[model samples]
Target: MIGEELEVLYEVDSTNEFLKRNYRSFHDGAVVVAIKQTAGKGRFGRTWYSPEGGLWYSVLFKPKVHIGLHVYTKIFSVSIAEVLKKLKVKVTIKWPNDIYYEGKKLAGILAEAISENNRVVAIVVGVGINVNNNIPDELKDIGISLSQILKKKVKITYLLDEINKYAWHLLVTYRNEPENITKLWKKYLYPKEGAQIKFKHEGEVLEGTILKISDEAMYIDVGGKVHVVQSIHELVE
Candidate 1:
């Protein structure tokens, strides 16, 4: 029953922030959607380009597992990719959380956790997808929308329904067999074969080949040395 309790706003600062402030009152599977976001956020304090014509929403979850927030992000990424594929949109996920279509970013997912007294409380997963919006000049080269790809206006209601359906299915799979989530994520990873990948760790660029990926980290072969990347600031492929 994911997204059973949905709150749609005409405008908001950030859906994730909104959920965090009101998390104590919301139940599991509650969702907050904003038609337009003034201060939407992305990973690492980046601003998420959210406008009226995009799908900007966040979901609240009370997971049984306390740790491994990255796993939840992977689950959402896979769910969105699966839904878009069914709509005849070719999409691939970049390592971590960015969704790409024809090498341009289509969507981004951010996961935030709330804890008290060293105990887990709730998790908020925010997603921003460009549907019928016109790409701003700054993002014109790197951002793309569903309408742009399909050359026609897409129905936002149908897309939201599909996303919620797949999200619930993946959430169930995650609670049952978490390893399958990693497998599905890797299966849809962009540049699936050997390719040069670079990520910054500890203020240093670590370039390598992506050997394998798990829920927590990525194993990379860099200069004959295997480096475990737990957190990446920038990823280039």
Candidate 2:
């Protein structure tokens, strides 16, 4: 029931952009939901497909703590995981900010914040979840949606309702029990173990085995050398 004041739209380049440009004078917890985004973007400036039949929305916040951007991104991902789990969907965090289902990306998060004098002014957490769209050929190998996997039409309203409830819960809990967020994130990590993943960090390609996922990040064993990664962009495949 948090920010149920939905500003539903037909199309926009980015919901986050809309909030950033217009929410300066608005209250926290305002929400902007869009049907289609011409230029939806993922983490690290990658293009996101937000044609239609998906949930594209952003929630505005002025956090109590002015944490680093990286920490905020983790919070965003954790929030998404919380909501997806409530909807009876098997989801996991893919670090930095992606929600995965059955080894393919089901949702992605993009967080944009405005800070002045080292104080946070506004934060827009953008979430894009594939709900009812047919999987495009280009992304079939790397992406999967709830509707596609379940063979049933998913309603945007249902997804949005869960998002509203979970978002409010996370925001409230974040202030009193931030550790709970990290604990839930660790509970559902993609490729939890025994899976080989390719990563590109510091301009080098490395393959590694996923050993464990924890509160800080993922424990990946690469050639007997373990690396704990927190950013999703650092992973290539």
> Which runs of model 1 end up more than 4 angstroms from their true locations?
64-67, 198-207, 228-233
Q: Which prediction has the highest lDDT against the true structure?
A: 1
Candidate 2 regions exceeding 4 Å error are 64-79, 192-237
TM-score of each: 0.90, 0.82
Model 2 lowest lDDT segment of ten: 66-75
**Local distance difference test scores for all models:** 0.85, 0.76
Query: On a 0 to 100 scale, what is the lDDT of residue 39 in model 1?
Result: 94
lDDT of 1 at 219: 80
**Tens-place lDDT digits, model 1, residues 34-105:** 999999898888998899999999999987766478777888898899999888897998778889998789
Pairs that clash in candidate 1: none
Candidate 2 residue-wise lDDT, 1-237, digit = tens = 456466888999899888888887557777888889998988667889988888888888776765445444566676667766666776777764788888788988788788779867888888888888767999999899888877889778877776667667765667556566656656665655678988886889889998976544667899899997876667786
Task: Estimate the lDDT of model 2.
Answer: 0.76
Which predicted model would earn the best TM-score? 1
